[model samples]
Target: MQDNDITVLVVEDDDIDYMTVKRSFSKRKIMNPMVRAIDGVEALELLKGKKIGYPYIILLDLKMPRMGGLEFLEKLRADSELKDTVVFVLTTSKDEDDIHYSYEKNVAGYFLKEEASDSMMSLVDMLDGYWRIVQFPTK
Candidate 1:
């Protein structure tokens, strides 16, 4: 798999955070297409309705207005069709419970949002490398 072969779904309610992701991707030269959802409910709608393609990864935030990341993960895991979807938790929450629950729900990784722009850039670079080498199940 290559970077262009995968899509990224970012579920975040904060506009600044979303922009940060975009900026980081740009800074890292990660050209993969990115889709945004304001919350878990919207993300679910997008996924369940086939609004997005396969071989995509999700960047999920734990806090939101309508539905949260944990709730979203529960729902996603319950649905057999989406159970294997790759998800990574990106949030400001440093709470141990949040970390544990996110891992319990099978997130690919959990990252804190307190890092600077440079950190985000590094994250995008790492993800780009990961998508290039990692193989995902075909739809």
Candidate 2:
């Protein structure tokens, strides 16, 4: 399927999880470009340096080294240029605080990665629909 113009920026630490997401999209024939960053630090650099363009959405994982998703969200929101960037929390963490804090950071949505492959497949399907109708801020 052809995505309008949305690119998925996946900020994940685990290789297996990352591959799971990629496989889901591939299986569905979704053609949206996927950029992967192992952790929040690299994710920030990618955003700051213009590696990934505007009109993109981030799929963030909560637990990661160097800087976790929450800290990244803090920095993202604090920056005037990147403050309004859309983010979706996709993590295995189901803690109450993580959920509450993620939404507090203005994340578009939150998803749990419980079943790994199956969950990722469902998540991919949902995201396909989301980007289809959603108009991202073009910075």
Candidate 3:
């Protein structure tokens, strides 16, 4: 894959979860860059950076400190610059409201964290395929 094939930004607060994701990516031999943010605020700042680069997919955790995922999504969705970025909520929440709200905000996908790691890997692989093989509108 080219350097710009797909960049992933993982917005998660839990350190353990972050490590798990890293380990999973390594185990699966994923070659894509995986940027990380501990909270929504940091994620936004990172996304706004001039040199950080575009994130093809965001693995978001809904419940986080320094602004939750929903609030972050609301702000991002309303922003003209970031509205088109693909966001995928990866959370443990099974709440109907969370799901509905995330979808309403135009998230590209949602996945339960408790599901098997293999399932998560499958999604990541699919995402890689989409971003690497499919043509998307570029800036």
Candidate 4:
């Protein structure tokens, strides 16, 4: 990957959902490297350990086995080194409280899984366009 390429960290526990995302990216010919985590705990390990490259964005799911997306966001925002990280929530939850709290934690955007159930084209396209034009702070 190029230095400017934005790595996508997908924190999803469901195998089907993860495959759907991968298929979408493949179909769209999105070349950015993707990193997967089964849950928030693993996601934290990657981020805190700097396993993924800089200029990355997280596509977070709200429900999971260990730590859910909200808790991950809480820890992410609290960490001085990662507070500025950008996150977008993608989940099956339509709960109003989930939406409210996700934004409260400063997620860049929130999308329901139903929106991308077919091909995930919409989400993939948006992310493609996003990383193309967005800027990140230098470390």
The prediction achieving the highest TM-score against the true structure is 1
Q: Over the stretch 10-122, how does candidate 4's per-residue lDDT look in tens digits? A: 99999989998898999988888899999999999999999998889999999998899999999999999999899999998999999999999999999988853553688
TM values, all candidates: 0.96, 0.93, 0.89, 0.94
Clash pairs (backbone) in predicted model 3: none
Report the Cα lDDT for residue 130, model 1.
89
lDDT, candidate 1, equals: 0.92
> How would the candidate models be sorted by lDDT, starting from the highest?
1, 4, 2, 3
Q: Whole-model Cα lDDT per candidate?
A: 0.92, 0.88, 0.82, 0.90
- Model 2 misplacement above 4 A: 1-4
Residue 39 local lDDT, model 1? 99
Q: Which should have the higher lDDT, number 1 or number 4?
A: 1
Question: Residue 97 in candidate 2 has what lDDT?
Answer: 96
Per-residue accuracy of model 3 over 67-102 as CA lDDT, tens digit each: 899999998888888888888898999999999999
lDDT score for residue 51 of model 3: 41
Candidate 2, 61-118: lDDT as tens digits: 9999999999999999999889999899998898999999999999999999887477
What is the lDDT for 26 in model 3?
76
Q: Model 2: how far is 68 from its true place, Å?
A: 0.6
Model 4, global lDDT: 0.90
Give the range where candidate 2 is weakest over 10 consecutive residues by summed lDDT: 130-139
